[model samples]
Target: MQALKEAQKTVVSNAPSAIFPANLDVEYVISFRYANGGQPAQTGDSSTPEEQLEKLLHTLDLAGLRTVVRDGGDGTLLIFTRIRSEKKLLGEIYRSRVRDWLHGIRPAAPEKETQQSIEKEPLTDGERLRLVYSLITLPNSEGGAGITPKQGEWNLVQSIFALHDHDFNKKWLKDWSTKWLIGPEDLKVIRDRFGEKIAFYFAFIQWYFIALTVPAAIGLFAYLFLPAYSSFFAICNCLWSVLFVEYWKRQEIDLAVQWGVRHCSTVQRKRAEFQFDAEATDPVTGEKIRYFPAYRRLMRQLIQVPFALVAATCLAAIIAGVFSIEIFLVEVYNGPLKMILKFLPTVLLSVFIPIVSTILTNFATRLTEFENYENQDSYEAALTQKIFILNFITGYFPLFLTAFVYVPFGEILVPYLDVLNVTVQHFGHDEKYTTSDTGFQINPSRLKAQMIYFVVTAQVVGFVLETILPQVKRTVFKKAKEFDSRRKGIDTQTVLDPPEEKKFLERVRHESELEVYDVTVDLREMCMQVSIFKRWEV
Candidate 1:
């Protein structure tokens, strides 16, 4: 039994990427080693992951049990290590084996024994084309279907557990669609990574911009004639932006039609994405409910209200502190410190805003757990809503206050010779206080200041918050995991524990997972830019 395990371990540990899939429903042979230590040969699994790798080792008999996967068993393991190459090998095995079976199943003529029979087989171009086309068009009768090979057959063959991956998506991706978006390709990854909501967002955006001309026009007009303060243009732009957003919402449904996603009957009748509550996988479909309706997602959304408030509080507090200091130094202070004080508000606000904002965002992240979204949509909707709130408050709120307040309040409150009480010495002559409404003009530099704040200061802030911070955090977390997993790697006591030669494997599973949220972020960032004409005007 021990020797069998040792051999099983060896066979699995070094299984080619062409053997079986991660979601093994059918098992195919992998490699055969003559118990006498002869050269090994590889085969494929036409069955599932269990039937194939779990088949008791070097001795074909049931000499021992080897776990095909580890932890949750949704994936495959070689020996005790969770290597993912088995799926690719399995896919190749499935294809080659199935193709051979198909060839055998096709009725063929016995070897032509006589000249008379060989002469009767004269083939014309038209007949050859018709026969060849018919043969190519036929399906595998055993499974009632054949694998649809696409351009990336080599890549697909490496994913032996393709069916499992597909099945996983087939079950979960359906329910996940409504609250989020999805596409034919992403259906599987969405089920695994962020769930349905995030996936649905992708599907929706892809579906949304099938006609992109309309929004482009509105943006162009806003660039051309719409002065920054034009009430008509402001109303039009705001209304238009909102209308486009709303229209896209409806368009998603219409699109859900042309692209095939509107009604979620599949998700509705299905299981939630994560069901820690369920005892075992279901019998009929062998899958638990992996999703739910938007109402539950909305329930999760309630958590965002406080998050927004907290973000607003943090943002306002930081900006107000800076504003107060700037106003006191510029307007009230008469010390020679005027020049030095000019930079104070910006410097202090820069530090305070990020610190406060970071704390609030952490608090907001904790709150997202309460969102209880079945798929990525409800989850991401709540997530992005918080993100948008942060963007708006940190980006727009300070400018709004500064634009209206600094001049208006300063003009009213600052000491000025009142026109009604002009000095007798100057009564006959025109008199004006340099501090009066007319002289206390809007700083021509204020617009430039605002723009600089965003372009330089705020941009640095954005990079820290979004890109640098997250990357640093990930690197730290990944290093910590590597250290811990190291000890686990050394602790195995079974025969499979012994060292064996390893072949080259190119990538890690799930490393290149696709995302729709990333796309949305890019588009929104582009929109946030000062339009081209606005920049040129500057």
Candidate 2:
């Protein structure tokens, strides 16, 4: 028995261990691609892709980060980053905690005895990633590698992102999908796994979802019991809106505190893209901070006023013109191919709104960049506000025109829509196709039908477009790429992955290909939904 046990132990020790590939040690990934789509020049300044990559590696080394470069396929190089010293990370964590405490963002001071005491608490994935990101992106003067991807000397750098924890993501998705409701603990898990920005978005969504139940119930009751445009229901909805806004403000603060990110805005790092005109010493901290002239930023901001007006004018004109044409086709005109012509307005809206919105969004982005806010938070906030304005016009204006203008004063507006009467007649339509028909009666159900379409049908369609369509497109594209590679007789597997670390490398490569997830997009969707719900309910 003793001899058998010894042999078993020896066999167990000799056997290859299973590869878990947790990937917890990897802090960040830097993706580099050749600008000219070929091998880098042998001799050049950091202007060359190869030279820039070398400089980046040197900077990372100086900042005490471990880096391993690998072929990312498609003439790209992936730099996997890890911390060389836990002590360095611990020190950064300690300093951050201390700053938070000083700024009243954190409730308690960090351990005074030693940095190891701070390490005892252990950094969450979010914290670790954030620190590493800052370490890589902050200015060289601020003790970072100062390698901002696609910026200045690092233009060859395609993207810098942290790898997703596939295990945690799978578990999280399964847990959430299984559960009926997400509790505070679930939110905390999200905060720990992701970061405050993403966590706050989810928290807000959860809060919004719960709060909506009241309005939804009330709206159902009102729909069933009350007359159209009931004053009582309107008042109730208005009250609910006020209460929701006030409570969310309080809840937002509470969540910020709970997540230990309250007053985090105070410690926002200077944006790498921020262009500064001068430097000044902070009165309180006595630190030298880069300064951009307020007057110049103010001048740039003033441009938004005109931009908003132009955007509103353009979008409203398109919507109003489309609405008029649709009314003429459906209500007034008895033209040839009338059913097919009725869908013209829908086609025009589908084609025009997106093109116009894209242009406006791009312009808004440029305007925001020109404003040159000191930090990313402010820049994003400004851009969001601008985009929200554009969205508000495009989203709500049509509904507003239908409900307020068409429904209320359709008899008057119907005559004005006769501007298309000549055009309809010229298209070989009969005289009855014109608005001169006496039989035409304004459809009161039109507004109700439109509301239903927006509230139910539009929501479903938006979900399909936002979630399902993107996923389907990604899968199709991936399969197409694989097929193309196989047809070309290229060994995609061997080219991208080595046998020893194939699983881990494959995971990294997959994550590298994913677009950086923006919490703002989700938040914007939520905000738009709220607007739709508010209008629909009232």
Candidate 3:
């Protein structure tokens, strides 16, 4: 106990504040046995688990550091000590350590040295951040504990999430309106506070917005000044849209590398709901995990291609019927209740689109299940890809029909709708309602108008649907429940006569209010955002 305590003192005392940022302190895995011996019999260490835990608490208390302890369930303890310094001070400390390391002088005690002495000094703030981040990511052999959930000797590390910096997010939103620039430091702050997955999304969004500015400016200029050359702008817009999607794919790869999650998917554990035919041991780690054959999964995935084709055919047929009805009513027909009849297709679409989408989504879910992805990330990614395809067809195919088929060839196509011209005698009008030689005057300006509506009006509607509608539904449901309870004379409110019971019930209520949405919802939002951007580009 004395030796371990002495070692702990040495480590804490000699630890230079330069090696780790004050606010971003290093977490340690204190695994030694306690002297009182609550641990299972081990030949080497004299201490018990309880004794070790007490010693750890005593040592931390003596050092005047606040420690958070997590029980690892297998006689292991995870500790996070409170020690922080200003960012500027940390930079200076790192620089000093670099100098000492280069000159063959030890900056701190051997036990406190986390990184090897480097001859090269980090020059810029970005480089310094990288150096610090790299140090933090290294393994214990390389001077960093690299302590994370499912990593290192303390592999079952509990997740320790810091409180979100809502202030920073608010400031970022305010700044984004005027600044139009999101720096790496801002992304780093997010990555440090949140996980890398979320940070990657923010980075990608920022990158996408910056990339979009050039095309948007050019497209707007062409649209205003070169009205006669509309096709030129349309072609350029399509090309730019394609380029953005392709660029984002590569950008994802780059960000994955920067975030050190390039092959992180490979290390991810299988989802708890996943089923397997057999179990196998990992060759390197000797851990038992459920196993499924890759070939069989691939064969299962081939089923999605046929499903996608079927969905696309159904969607295309619906879009075509809706577009044809719209054209016939708007241009060819001159009859009573014209405006009301024109909305028939739209009303039908509004009613049926959701039904079709839900059916297709359920089918996609089944396909994904059959594919049997090992991890949640992989499962979500595959499912999101399938959903994006469906959303793309339903959301954009109508516009595509208007752009490519209707506008370009409307002169020939609208006349075909007059196949009923021969049967006009049945109406008893005697004067035939045959189509005129001029056919329908298809205005190209309508496409631009539709694009404008989609960009501005549709997005506002979508936002209300995505965010406000759910809350509205929830509020209505809760109110209805309350009304029913009142009618039954059931008191929903807890009586607070007993303080202990009240506190316990209140804790339970608070926990109940914390909701976790299905992963698919988050991925769907991301997919929809991408689709919205693509629509704007088109």
Model 2 over residues 1-538: C-alpha lDDT tens digits? 1222232232212211111126624567888886332345222343666667788889998986778787776567888776565456656777788888898887878787444544455566677678778888877767778786665677778899877766777888999999778999999888777778888888787778788888778878888998888888888888888898899999999998788888888887767778889988999999988889899999989999999999999999999999988898888877577889998987898779978998999899889988999887899999999999998997789889887898789988687767777887786566755555665578888877777777777778678767787778778987887787778765545363557567777777777777677778778877887777676656
Per-model TM values vs. the true structure:
0.41, 0.86, 0.58
Overall lDDT per candidate, in order of appearance: 0.42, 0.76, 0.57
Q: Measured by C-alpha RMSD in angstroms, how accurate is candidate 3?
A: 12.7
Instruction: Score candidate 1 by TM-score against the native.
Output: 0.41
How high is the lDDT of residue 238 in model 3?
A: 77
lDDT of 1 by residue, 376-395 (tens): 45555566667667766766
| lDDT-based ranking | 2, 3, 1
Name the top TM-score candidate.
2
Error of 3 at 17 (Å): 19
Superposed model 1: Cα runs more than 4 Å off: 1-228, 235-243, 265-311, 326-351, 368-392, 412-441, 444-465, 468-538
Worst 10 residues of 3 by lDDT: 28-37
Error of 2 at 454 (Å): 3.2
Clashes of each: 52, 0, 9
Ten consecutive residues with minimal summed lDDT in candidate 1? 148-157
Which residue pairs collide in model 3, if any?
Answer: 22-84, 22-85, 34-47, 34-48, 34-51, 34-52, 35-47, 37-48, 114-143
Give candidate 1's root-mean-square deviation (CA, Å): 17.3
